[model samples]
Target: MSQEKLEKIEKAGFVLKPDSPEIRPNYERVREAFESRGIEVLLAERSARMIGEKGMPFERMCVESDFLVSLGGDGTLLSLVRRSYAWHKPVLGINAGNLGFLADVTIEEVETFLDQLFSGEYRIDHRLMIAGHIRKASGAKIEFFALNDVVISSPVTSKMVIVNAAIDGERFNSYRGDGLIISTPTGSTAYNLAAGGPVVYPLTKAFILTPVLAHSLTNQRPLVVPADFRIELDTEKYEAVATIDGQERYDLEEGDVVTIGGAKEGARLLHRKERNYFSVLRDKLHWGERNW
Candidate 1:
């Protein structure tokens, strides 16, 4: 939860869905709306190139703008968040695709939302992010951050992956399954949900460890731990790949160690002050609906 209101949003940076030219009209319309409110709109280079407009570099846009906007689906928003994490700017997601869990604001609501935004009636959420690294056998390290989860899964679907888990340097359990998802509370409704993991509130500070298709007699289940504890995972048998936020991937060798923990700063998300998380869950997941 955010306690302070935004201090007069003047300039906003926009990033559109990749390779989608059909969204140019939507982009123009939204850009007009923001301009009408006296907000200077800065388009990212890639998105501008896709839409045939002049644009600035992404780093420059992030630096000059008061906040960032993602005009696409949840996937687009995820990409924007991860890429702009270094800038530490608040992100606003405009939904143009289906199943908009992270990108909740609809196209129709842009005008009204902008009004609320200017009037300081918007909410900014601090969602936990994953700061992780992969230590290779040759002592090289690859570092990355994720707003969702870090998944360790086998490349071959037929072979089960054996992942050894340790908490703070202490060996705990071994997960022999299709894969393992170490998700944040904000990502509980994604792959974690499909794998039978609980839907945790996005504001909660916790790490969710959910196993996908476990092949064990003990019947392994999803485990939620405090964000402070560091988790280490490695596979000894079959080769595995570690995926960050479902967007980036790194091949893991037998001796490579993957370490995951909460990021120092969480991602700041801008939303409607009146938006309800449970209502979104019900609407998206049909929680209380029953077919007659």
Candidate 2:
């Protein structure tokens, strides 16, 4: 192997999602492939547990690893992206589920993917992130970041909630609805799309505000905002909750305020050579040539 090729392969450390049964077997196969060639393998804590790994902190595994691999669907890829952002590591996604926009590489492609990766045949794309700071009138503050979206909504069975949103400290709009989604361009295809938001290009530098099942017909559409603006939502008069990436949740009380903006750091994602956004859309949504 060439000096640069060996350097690239030797410098990589892998991070895999633990829940998938396929990951353990695939991990072993990949481990053997690398070990046979004298390359090192680093595993995330949760993944280590699944593979019977012991004697290392999970965070340390990520910090030491150069390339992290997420071995599941889009959600797994999202979690890995957040971890990579926190650790400043780049991530590769291997899809094992349906609608895997992020995790596009299939199991059959793993070996070839790794080879291309070491040979510098792939490209890395950085996706924008959103950070939110929530405060209550009583003086408590909480901070969170998301690769997908930050959602603010009322508890199940609760009445419609009212929110006053401001962009760049100026009054943007007051919404009377079930909830609101503040999504990154990468997330425009996720929950935002289901909520009627436009499918923005992944590389677009913009934010989307999509209302969920609004009570009023006039408030039915989604709003796209500039990525650099600061967005604030005042829920001081309503009962609500806040969520990030559909994983973390926080309760909202009267007089509580939530602020969201573009994050200084973003996620670096590795894309396979054959992956295409329009191709995925056409295949997943069945958008072409109807026989009926």
Candidate 3:
């Protein structure tokens, strides 16, 4: 941590989810408490629809603030990260979901957490992101960014497609499956986990490739690769689509080459004093021995 970074966080911003009924009151209470103590708050306008309550006026808030605190589940936290692409604000998540690998605090700890935050007792971890480029044979291309996995699959399409996987210009494998997933370390616990990929920790600098419902059982397990290596997907079938963090999607044509790799930018995630990766995993995954 640079001194400049530390100073940047001393004056923090806040982004809250206003849609979750269970989370709305807590958000308001936390906001009031923090504001009463002289902390700056920046609320996301979309929260109004999400919480079924009128959110803070967007015009009154400035996007370029210090750091941002996200009040919701992992999904809500991801939304803040995406919205902060240009702002590049550090984000802290408060867990309101069943499993909150990304969300670090609980609603009950908001005030104390804020106190510790102002006291400079917390740390920020830089989490890697995936950069995806959609290329068309006609010289048109669109590039996007994500803090989670990039999925290219049929999901519910009527037919299976073949995708040739390449890493750093070398052929890796050919997959005959419903789709393929290229996930960041932060995403290993998300859709990648449900698809049977390993739960990579925050410190890992790697990307994961998991095949979705491959036609063959022999090559179904997920593979992890170095973060900087360029990954390409060559498909022989049309109608394939690519999604970023399940928030954005695009269509893929036959022979379209999609490249994915570590993003130049990343999310600055904040963690509380009592929070650690192993602790979160143990609680979220129920990793301890069973009481048989």
Candidate 4:
């Protein structure tokens, strides 16, 4: 949980779901709602072009706005947060898709949320982010950031991968399976949950290493470590792909090393003051429900 309150939100930058022109009407309605509250709306170039409106550069939008908004599902919110990370502007996600973990606010609730925002009756959550890099065998490097988890998996479905793990410069274990998920607490409910990893509290400062479908007879389970510790993984003999937040990917050769650690600064998310994590879990995961 973050104790930081937003400064007066005079202007807000918005990025809509990509490749969807049908979302224009919803964007208009939300823009009007914000304008009615005396808040200016700035749209990103690509998003505005999709809706047939003039827009500014993304960098400029980030610089000029007090905060940012994502008008889609959790994926859109994730993209916005990662792109505007250098700005450190707080973000609000208005859900235009299914019920989402991060985009908690719905379109119908935008007006009410705006009222709450102006009244200083909102909360901002600071969630952990992953700062990672891949060192290629050729001595080149690729850097990326993720709000969820970093996954290293085999390129072919029939082949399994052997990922050797090291922590803080010490060899630890080798995961021989489909792949491995290096997840932050914020990603515990994503692929991590489906692979039997624990649902750690989002604010917990920890890294979760969960192997997917291990080929070992001995006991192999998810491991949680302090976020400050560095984790290094390399595919021993198999070709692999490294995915960040399930959006971006990079090919990995046999000696390439993938390094992951907690970012210095986390992401800030704006939400209703009454939002509850346990309630979300119950609703989203259908926990404690009798299926007669």
TM-score of each: 0.98, 0.90, 0.88, 0.98
Q: Write the per-residue lDDT of candidate 4 for residues 142-252, one digit (tens) a residue.
A: 989899999999888857999999999999999998999999888999999999999999999999999999989987899999999999999988889998888898999
Candidates 1 and 2: which is better by lDDT?
Answer: 1
Error of 4 at 245 (Å): 0.1
lDDT of 1 by residue, 1-292 (tens): 6875666589999999999989999999999999998999999999999988999999999999999999999999999999999999999999987748889998899999999997888899999999999999999999999998899999887579999999999999999989999999999999999999999999899999999999889989999999999999999889899998899999999999999999999999999999999999999999999898
| Alpha carbon RMSD to native, model 2 | 3.5
Q: Score each candidate by Cα lDDT.
A: 0.93, 0.77, 0.77, 0.93
Candidate no. 1 TM-score: 0.98
Give the runs in model 2 whose Cα sits over 4 Å from its true position: 1-7, 18-22, 34-38, 217-219, 289-291
* RMSD, candidate 3, Å: 2.8
Residue clash pairs of candidate 3: 18-50, 18-51, 19-50, 19-51
Top-down TM-score ranking:
1, 4, 2, 3
Candidate 4: give the clashing pairs. Answer: none
Q: Which runs of model 4 end up more than 4 angstroms from their true locations?
A: none
Q: Candidate 1 lDDT (Cα, whole model)? A: 0.93
What would the per-residue lDDT of candidate 3 be over residues 108-169, giving only the tens digit for each residue?
Answer: 77778877877877878888977779787666888888898888887467578778899999
Runs of candidate 1 exceeding 4 Å displacement: none
